[model samples]
Target: MKCHRCGREIPEGDNYMHLGETLCEDCYLDIRMAVKACDPWAVHSATRFREGSGHKGTEGLTDLQKEIYELVKGKGKVRKEEVIENLNLSEQEMQRQLATLRHCELIKGRKEGDKVYLILYR
Candidate 1:
């Protein structure tokens, strides 16, 4: 069977049905935890954790996470699409990574005129 969300071919009995739509595991998870770029609680918690941990500036991040941070840091500000293309990440993958980075207080989204840009936090 083919997944309704991503069009990937799923073996029988391995597909997830969500809201009457068939989805692969990855797509289902992505839909379940939709990205929230402007979550104040996430920011506050991340800040508190960072202060308590004493690890500064991407010291305790995964390799991929650090790469994302550096990309945003070097560019100063970048569009979401640019990150996706540059990192060769799927939309869902990018969202998941971005959410984690945001929760860690490493990156944030900013609106300038008609576009949203990703920039390093602080």
Candidate 2:
């Protein structure tokens, strides 16, 4: 079987059914715990954690997080689809990573006309 969300192949009996859609474990979790970038509490908690942890300015980011940061940094600003295509990331993966980056105040989203773009945080 294949996940309806991410389109990854799943072994028999390993897929989960949600609202009549077959989803993989990752997709299920992602849907259940979707990130909220505008939550002030989360931003405060992440900021406090980073400050106390002595990790500054992407110092303790995972490899993928750093890669995403660098990609945005290099581009100045890029459309959401551009990052998705450049990194070959699923939409869910991109959202998770972008949320982390946003919580760290390392990146932000902007609107120009009808589209949103991601850029390094000022």
Candidate 3:
């Protein structure tokens, strides 16, 4: 079978049905288990991991994370839709990356009237 989301071929037993769509394992997990940016424990753990590993600034981050940080830093502020469009990212994937960036305290969200913007934390 093929995954409805990414059009990837699914192995016999590795397909998942979500919201009436057949998805491969990765796509299924993307929709079902988005990481949250507001979990205090997550922030603490990410901080300790960075400190323990002596990582500074964007050090130790994934390439995608660094790219996201750079985009936000360069733009000053951006909407979620803009990031997704500019990076060609799925909403679920974008949320996961954003959550990680937030846990590292590299980015934050601000509400401006009816819309929210992503910006550097400091």
Candidate 4:
């Protein structure tokens, strides 16, 4: 079976069902686990972790997170939809990754006119 969300092939017994959709392990876990960027404790924890580990910029981010950062950095700014399309990620996945990056103070959003774009935090 193929995951309904990510379209990855699911091995014989590894598929999961959610709201009538079949999902792979990764997609299932991603949906089950979510982190909010606006949580003060999350921000504090990320800040403390980065400072204590001496990891600057994108050093401590996941490979995908780093890629997202680089994509934004390279472009100066990009719409959320553009990043989601470029990375081929679900909206939820993009939100989670962007949350982590935002918590780490690596990326942020900017409003230009009526549009919001993701850009490096400075």
Clashes of each: 0, 0, 0, 0
lDDT of each: 0.79, 0.79, 0.81, 0.81
Q: Give the Å error, residue 89, model 2.
A: 0.4
Task: Report the C-alpha lDDT of model 1 over 1-122, residue by residue, as the tens digit.
Answer: 89997799988888898899999888777766644442556556655776998845565456777888889989999999998888898887888888777766789999999999999998
Residue 95: error of model 2 in Å?
0.8
How many Å off is the CA of 29 in candidate 4?
Answer: 7.4
lDDT of 4 by residue, 25-56 (tens): 98777655534323456656766777888855
- Runs of candidate 4 exceeding 4 Å displacement: 1-56
* Candidate no. 3 TM-score: 0.58
TM-score, one value per model: 0.59, 0.58, 0.58, 0.57
- Tell me, by TM-score, which candidate is best: 1
The lowest-lDDT stretch of 10 consecutive residues in candidate 3 is: 31-40
Model 4 residue 118 CA deviation (Å) reads: 0.6
